[model samples]
Target chain A: MSLPGCYPLHDAIIAEKLTKYYGDFLAVDHISFQVRKSEIYGFLGPNGAGKTTTVRMLCGLTRISEGKAYIYGYDINRELVAIKKLIGVVQDISNLYMELSCYDNLMFCAEMYGVPRHQRKERVMDLLRFFGLEDKKHVKFKELSKGLKRRLAIAAALVHKPKLLFLDEPTIGLDVKSKRQIWNLICKLNEKGITIFLTTHNIYEAFRLCDRIAIINRGKIIAEGTPTELRKKVSGNKIIELQVSPPIKKSTILDNVDGIIDVNIGRDNTIYITINDAIAALEGILEIVKKLSLEIVMLNLRGADAEDVFIRLIDGTEKNIGSSTRR
Target chain B: MIDMLRLEDIIKAFYIAKKDIKEYYLKPPTISWGIVFPVAFTLAFILKGGHHAQEIIPGLIALALFFGTTSMAAASIVFERKIGSFERLLLFPVSYIGIALGKTLSSFMFGMVSLFATLVVVLPFILNIPTYSLFLVAVLILSALMFSAFGVFISFLIKDPTNTMMIFNSIRLPMIFLCGIFIPISSLPLPLRLIAFLLPLTYSVEATRFAINGNYDVVPPIESILLMLIITILLILLTSIKIRRTIP
Candidate 1:
């Protein structure tokens, strides 16, 4: 199945220093990465962090200003037809024809990708059933709910049975249940041997779905590794959870306590602190609480998570990139 | 590169055309712009001119086709861009030329259908002579092709839907008076006549006048058809180039 290319046959996507510029603004810096076959590779970044631009470049929706990219051993620029046949992209918006019925929408996609006429109907129906949208097949896309619209968009992308699926913010604005369902669907798609390239700002979604994650900021990829590897490499902060009877500001113990990286106030008077050395920071935190006459209702030590990693990275570059990049 | 001349690409173009007709031309906005706008303009001309309606009928029908093809065609693509659906079309395995042809084909079909539907009502009142059916059909097809390609070009150049309509109307509104749609081209001022000669619609209107009334005074029908075909090819080429700039 190798398409006569220099890139490894096992690699589904290989982007080498791909760049994009919008007028004078550098939207994507010299970025490079690879996605192996059937693995869910996540590009985790905040808004305007160039994740979407990178995906667009790789998909040939936007031209790469410099360098090269290959999809299943086909060059993105020279072999766009071959690359397009190998890929499907679910954009940020579920942008199927609003006037067409769900069944018609998928059928139109099947036609666009040149799915064989005899097999198109059956493929569309199978996708509808898989997405739990068979009952809404006859309904116009505009009449469907946001969740259904998103689901149909994904189904439409799969009509031609793409090998590498690009999902840009797959579950951006969804309820907890709908998001979880989409997460499960993503897992199912990956299990079906479809290589997934996911871009998201959601920490939990990235942690839950991605096999390996790349953290990007200011148009540059800062770090990339597996969930466990990311935690071990750059996500080395210790998390301390303390619920005080009297609520205190996040900055109240900043100067008084050393080794504390960042602090966030959670629900129910609980405070989550990301620190370098938990032993020294915890003693300093206890003394500060005693001096302030605030009772510690509950105190527990927790392992570092995606949030701690994100805050650690954001805080590390706060001086270089002015204003908080966290959203 | 995918060849636009390939059979597979042509089939894909037809697929895109079918989708566009079903997804855009059947909508309320398209129906209103494609048929009602031209009919209203025709009605106004008929009411104002009274007995002179016979002389202006051919031009009016040509004018209707001009507006019918351009207005909704531009609106459909620009609206797709606004809703982010047009980008989806670009992601498909179709060439830029194929995409332009598909959009032009859709608009051409809509223009022809809408014009004939309007003609059914108007022709009953004006049917007194043996009409040149085949020649008229040929003239209609060329005019539709020119306008449809022009509209597709406009869609590729302008990104916003409202702004596209504004630009189309700004050009189309003035064309009605300039292209001899209601007035006689021979009697127009020298400067205006020169301007009219520069417009593609002028030849189309003149050819329609010949096909409907057996008059070839302003311009010859053969020459008019030749000019229309040239303009259609040019517009489609320009549209494909303009749309390609979106990628790089």
Candidate 2:
């Protein structure tokens, strides 16, 4: 299916059938996506879904097994040095200098990027303040808490003010406060006109932070859209949950209901029904309950969100929704 | 622009050297290996007797320099790699050669400092020995450079720091025995002498002996210097290749 505006709008990154293989195992299958300039694009996937591998391939940290990708129109394989200068990568692991103090780590990164010496000190200090790590400047990286270490890693990556930032699971294994802080930092960075390509397994983070997201599963792009768009794709059906007083055994009675699409009965005697129209299917559901003489204690209707869309898509139950997926 | 790129690499190398020295140079393990071990080893030789000490003084100094530099260099690289900073270094725009040179230079400096300390401790014992100060300093610097390159090369080959030390001990202990450090190369049997010829430390020992005693074995002092220079270059080249491949 064609992606909306997939024609490359001064694209910061573009991948066409990008693939990777480790020995005989295919780690990443043919996957294609584009990230536009100043866009906050999220790569959402589960563990070992090839999200990290794809990010590495884009940043020139790992060799691509097949297909092509470009950063600012430069071929990823041939123009890596040029690409390296334009992008900053924060890997899944906090790969910073543990022996060096926070200040030294930022300074060293600045020097490596050829930041002018006159501006180096100022820039490092500014980053320390920006990340709220100014007081921890003298502390060795190993001595800091895990959240501070991650903040320092991100600070070091931005030492050169890269045009595009690739953050791989930036909020993984962090406290809620730290996660929220990092989320604000990400938004601030994007506001300064830097393109962000974030890979995350946290469904809420993707929904809250990303302007557009692509769901990947088993090394392929399963769905792609804004959170609202994705939620809408699963909106044709509504979910109704019922708590019954007397536990009903058989759900086959609702199979003949005209508008009921699917029925699931929980061990707690709660029946969940999915239908194209909740109002149209409610009478039929109530009729079955009446026949069984089971009292309906409570009824609730839940709206679809990104999480629901993601679960339905990954579970392979919403096959019709993904066939024409677009972002 | 080309000049700027070259200048940036030089600056980066210096930065790495400075960072390494600050982080690992004066740490307890470095001090123990660089200062304490050499002094203890030298004192052991001196306690054996005056005559034996006189004969082995130069060898002891060479041993000190070799072990001190190699250990510091290998340990630093392995530790950085273990802590995941080495992979971060690879993400920067610096050349592989710059990184190798930065590490080599720091290791070489550590070796030089250790050698000087060894000399200070050995000074009072000797009464009359021929002195060629300039040649001696030159030989010592070249030897340190060669060994530092060797250390970096070995660090790249071995991933784990503990395993690297194990392999380092196995390799360096044999080199000390086979090199002309304790015994002159000519005194060894044919096969053993052949092994001595192949070791870089052999050239360092022979050249140092010639400078101090006005006598040489195997190759002349000038040839030994040339061989050390060649080995240093070859090792540095090999280290650059290794860094590029391993990091990429």
**Each candidate's iRMS in angstroms?**
1.1, 1.9
* lDDT (CA) per prediction: 0.83, 0.82
Query: Tens digit of lDDT per residue, candidate 2, span A171-214?
Result: 99999999999999999999999999999999999999999999
lDDT of 1 at B52: 77
Q: What is the per-residue lDDT of model 1 for residues B102-129, given as tens digits with 9 covering 90 to 100?
A: 8898888889877976686567546455
Runs off by more than 4 Å, candidate 2: A1-9, A247-256, A265-270, A319-327, B1-5
Tell me model 1's lDDT, rounded to 2 decimals.
0.83
lDDT of 1 by residue, A1-327 (tens): 435555678989888898888889999999899899999999998899998999898888898898888888887878887788889999999899988999999999999899999999999999999999999989999999888888899998899999999999988888888888889999999999999999999977898899999988889888898888877754455667788877876556656688777676664556767677888899899888888899989888766567656655645542211112123
Clashing pairs in 2: none
Q: Candidate 2's error at A43, in angstroms?
A: 1.0
Candidates' RMSD to native: 3.3, 4.3
